[model samples]
Target chain A: MTINEIQDELIADFAFFDDWMAKYEYIIQLGKELPLIDAQYKKDEYLIKGCQSKVWLHADYRDGRVIFTADSDAIITKGLVGLMVRVLSNHSPQEIANSELYFVDQIGLKEHLSPTRANGLLSMIKQMKLYAITLQAKTT
Target chain B: MMEKTAVLEQFDVYGIRKDFPILTRTVNGKPLVYLDNGATTQKPLQVIDAIRHYYTELNSNVHRGVHHLSQLATDAFEVTRHQLKGFINAAHDHEIIITKGTTDSINLVASSFGSAFVKTGDEIIISAMEHHSNIVPWQLLCEDRGAVLRVVPINAAGELDMDAYRALLTDRTKLVAITYVSNSLGTVNPVREIIEAAHANGTPVLLDAAQAIQHIAIDVQALDVDFLAFSGHKMYGPTGVGVLYGKEKWLDAMPPYQGGGEMIKEVTFEKTTYNELPFKFEAGTPNIEAGISLAAAIGYIQDIGMDRIAAYEHGLLEYATARLLEIPGIRLIGTAANKSSVLSFLVDGAHPYDVGVILDKLGVAVRTGHHCTQPLMDWYGIPGTVRASIAMYNTREDIDTLAAGVQKAASMLV
Candidate 1:
């Protein structure tokens, strides 16, 4: 599925929740199901800065597509990381880089991505795009 | 015990809550349960009104100009210094130096006092439980002067190891800067004992009273502490204003922190002589509004009486500790015998930030993460703990709400 299709699916899924607690409960469940990153890549070199919680991200380029994996010490941040991975992973670098993630706001999780939140979701998005841009540069 | 209960009953926490307008507000559609007082307290209407009065009536540059507004502003600004001198019971009003805040005050002492006294091969003593504000300045001073920095270790209960601290205090010790109360742990240190131990070696001690000044009644003369620093915001005053109360001898001897208009006797091309005590440290056009407004905060506290305030907060702390302990998977950090109002804790196998976020959704505002005491966090071998620090306005109901929030968070996260 394309990034926009995945985001739309997420927004629709979140719309079913009646209250903030229900939405957060779903996110917390998603946090438990996040795809674990390679243990070797979980060092300071890959650690994203500016987060109150520690987050590590790694990218791999294969079959002319960029695959992304991430992890966070915080469950909520991990859940957000899971969403980012679902939307952006296994896509062409240009497609990934150009993707506009509006579903975050639609799903009532926009606050988690704010710079002031310090949860690293915004930084995670930036890091993912930077990876895509760099990988796209290598082919040219 | 009966007398204590009587004082707590007379305290009237709900009445005090009305004075703070922010207490009436809500967060996330629930009544705001503000437990982040250790970070910065909500200002009373008195303090807020004083700020409005300063701008509306006496908005003029202080310590200058031959106008009525200037005189009013100057008089108001100086009144805070006098109030602070009485509030902390400093030896002289001139000993109160208006600073940016506690961090700025600590940096002032570190820079000026370090330059005057600290030298190469000298040692400065600080404790493990100090906030980064109290720790970083001394580290910078030590780094600049080629001096060594020594730390007093804390026990598992987060209490300072007095035996270890005494052993660390040696002839090489140039200064001892420690916090009177731990912001993260809520451990009230034996500051009088700590001061006496340092004084035995003729070393001047600087007490970071940013946490203590609001909770405890401090008499600098009685404590015989050479330097005491605190911020106004923590005590229900406006931000950007703090007080540094130094002994007359030290204030007289130390070089000026910042060379500027008010801090200097006179400026010349050749050499500029510094001004007298308090003014020598206050360099620029000060935080005039906050300086004046701080007097209102003091008046608010004094009118209620510090003894009554302490008794009320102690009751809240006891009630909170008991309520929170009933929740399963709860681990209370800083289990010191004596503590102020801070309650730092963690749920089993749950991150502090996640718990904090959950609590926020429930309209319970708590401070999460290291509380700027990274070294202490490192010692604990945990990332951080969720800290709910109480203030005078907080009641038993607030504690119940917090306990419920924490229970909900733990059930969700753990």
Candidate 2:
């Protein structure tokens, strides 16, 4: 799916929840269901810095597209990672780099997320884009 | 609703709360319930005014001036030294050395004491539950001098293992630095027994009282501790000011930590001679405003009476502990038999950061993370805990909010 299409679907999915509690419950469920990264990819080299909880992210660039995998010790952080991977994974590296990611604001996730977590989300996105840029160089 | 115990009702918490203006502010549309006292207590109006009063009226350098303003500033600044001498019950005013904070004080001792006494093969013992402030200084000292750093272990309940500590203390040990109370765990160490045991080995002890000086009454003479360090901001005071109380003989024996203008008796291209007692240690023109306000903070705590404050906070701790345990998934860390007013816990299904976030929305401020004691977290095999530490002005109602907030958080997360 297109990044916008995926974000729209996410917004619609979140809208089904009536309250913050329900939304968080849904996120926790997503965290439980997330495809965790492989143990080898969970090394410090793939670890994303600036997260209060330890988060490991790995990217595979194949057929000019990037597939991102990640994991976190914190369930909420893991859930947030799942949301990020769903939106940007299986997309072209250039498309991932240029993605606006308005879904975060549209879903009101940034507003609800704590300041530190919000910063962590930004860091996650920046790291993903940097990975995409590095891989897009190899493609060229 | 939480029922206030009669013992707690004796304290004029309402009257006391009014002195702190920050308590009046709101967080996330609800009345602020600050439970992060272990991190740093909110500043009081008395301390605020004292800072302003210093800048407005008495703004001049201390000790070296023959001018009128200098004399006024010097007297007010020295008044805090005397107040701290009484606050910690040090034998003399010269025993107190002013520093930037608890970290700076510990660093000062580690550098000076390590140079004077610690040898290449000597050992310095510390405890497991110590804050990073107490642990890192000794580690750095050991690294610099090629000395060995030995740590005394703690049990699952967060109490220091006295037997392990006794075994670690040997004649080759130069210093035994440990926290009087654990900042993250709230476990009050048996400092007296520890001090006595170390003294038998002729090792000087330094108590990191940063977390204890505000909650408990300390008599340095009675404790016979060679050194004690604490910060002003942790006890309703301004920041950037702290005291390191050392016995006179030790201060006389140790080399100066810094070389600056005020700390010297004579300086020449040929050589420099150091000054005496406290002045020998206090290097530059210190935090003038913070120094003057430290007296106000000490006086405010003194007027309220430490015993009454300790009793009231003890009640809050007990109430909070009971209330938190009543929740289904709550598991409290640091279940020390003799604990201070610190409550560090975790919900079975929720991360501490997520719990802290939900609590903040409910206007309950708590500290969540390793709390600068990653070693302690590793000891417990947990990443961190949500700590709700209480002060004298905290009421039973605050804990009720915290408990209810945690329940709400758990329900949402689970």
Candidate 3:
């Protein structure tokens, strides 16, 4: 599915849930549906620093778009990564670079995360964007 | 749960629990069994009353006030400095500097001391079991200066390896900062021994005593520490008020942390002269109400006696640990020989968050995550652990409630 389509579905699912528990359960389910990165990509180069959860991310430039795959030891964080990947992947490197992921705020994800977890999420997104920028520079 | 009368007679746990108003609230239709004391403790009535009384009766800026109300307020505020001097057994009141919290206290030391004494190629030694507060400040300092930070590793039992700590000390090591207790693992580090070893190497040491002040007694003079930092909120006091105890000589030697109103002796357009020892570190209008309330909290703790509180909490830890160990597939973390009342564990197949959610539904509040020691968490090779840290007010009944909740959660998850 396209990024906009996934975001629409997320908004719809969020509206369907009346309570926090339901929202959390739905997020976990979304995390379960995240496509796993190939095992070969789970190397030191793709490793994220300073996260308690073992999160791996890899990005590639394919036909003017950035294709990214990610996985995590944590379910919720994996879901968080899935949310990010769904938004950023299959888009032009420039678009992915320019766009802010307001979906996190739209869904109020940071409010639910503990301070440390919120920091980890921020670090992961920052690293992913940095990698995309590096790819953008290479293509230029 | 234990028999009410017997528990009441044996220990004044009920009367003690009554002092904490937040404990009476219901979370998810049940009484809140808050076990996250190591993170931040709940304030008692005495502390709350002291804060209210300060603002209501004695409301004036300290030190410079000449009016009648100002004298009363200044005296009350300075009274806390004397109280903390007695609380930590510091040599003099001038040694105590009020800070925002332990984090600010440690940062003050790192910024001021690091700029003054730490030079390029100098080494700073810290422990593997340190909270991020202790680790990050030194890391930032080392990054700014060309100094390197060497870590004293922990053993398999979650205790600081004394051998490693000693081995890490070298001629180039300028500072050695260590936490008195491991917040994540409940390991009570041999801080005196660590200090002595560091001093032997001619290195100054700072003790992050944030976790230790509540669970154990602290004697800054006896420990021979160069500096010590602790938060009031962790010791049954109000938040935003903490004490930083440094030797008079060291405090006098180091530059002021923040350049602001209170810390200045004279401020001219060309130059500014700083104040003396404690006030040199304290800048801006202080948290006067919280400071006064903290004195009351310290008085309350003193009335109960630190020894007695330690004994009661040790009993609770023993009881809780044994009960938790009986549950199948549970791995207890931080099994140090000398430990605090923290019980951090993980079940075989359940995520720590899942365990925390189930427990919360049963009205047992626990901290689940890396506990801000992500480096230590990385060392353990787990995402996080569910932690139930005990305090003086917690009873055996509280532990029983926690055990039952964990068992129920385990059954559902497994």
What lDDT score is found at residue B247 in candidate 2?
Answer: 96
Q: What DockQ, between 0 and 1, does each candidate earn?
A: 0.75, 0.45, 0.20
TM-score head-to-head 1 vs 3, winner: 1
Candidate 2 accuracy as lDDT: 0.88
**Candidate 3 — which residues are off by over 4 angstroms?**
A1-72, A75-140, B1-9
* Local accuracy of candidate 1 as per-residue lDDT tens digits, A1-140: 89999999999999899999998888889999866699999999989864468889999899999988899989988988988899999999999889999999999888888777787778889999998988889877
- The digit string of per-residue lDDT tens for model 3 on B1-414 reads 445334345778888889989999999788889999998999898999999898899988887778998899888888999999999999999999999999999999999999989999999999888899999999999999989999999887899888988988999999999999889999999988988898899999999999999989888888899999999999999999998899998888899999988899999999999998788898998998988788999999999889778877887898899999988889999999998979999988777866776687778889988898988988998888999999999977889999888887677555
Better of 2 and 3 by lDDT: 2
Model 1 stretches with alpha carbons more than 4 Å out = none
Candidate 2 residue spans exceeding 4 A from truth: A1-23, A43-45, A49-51, A98-122, B1-5
Candidate 1 total steric clashes: 0
| Candidate 2 to truth, TM | 0.94
In candidate 3, which residue pairs clash? none
Candidate 2 structure quality by residue, lDDT tens digits, B74-151: 999989999999988899999999899999999999999999999999999988888888888888989999999999
DockQ of 1: 0.75
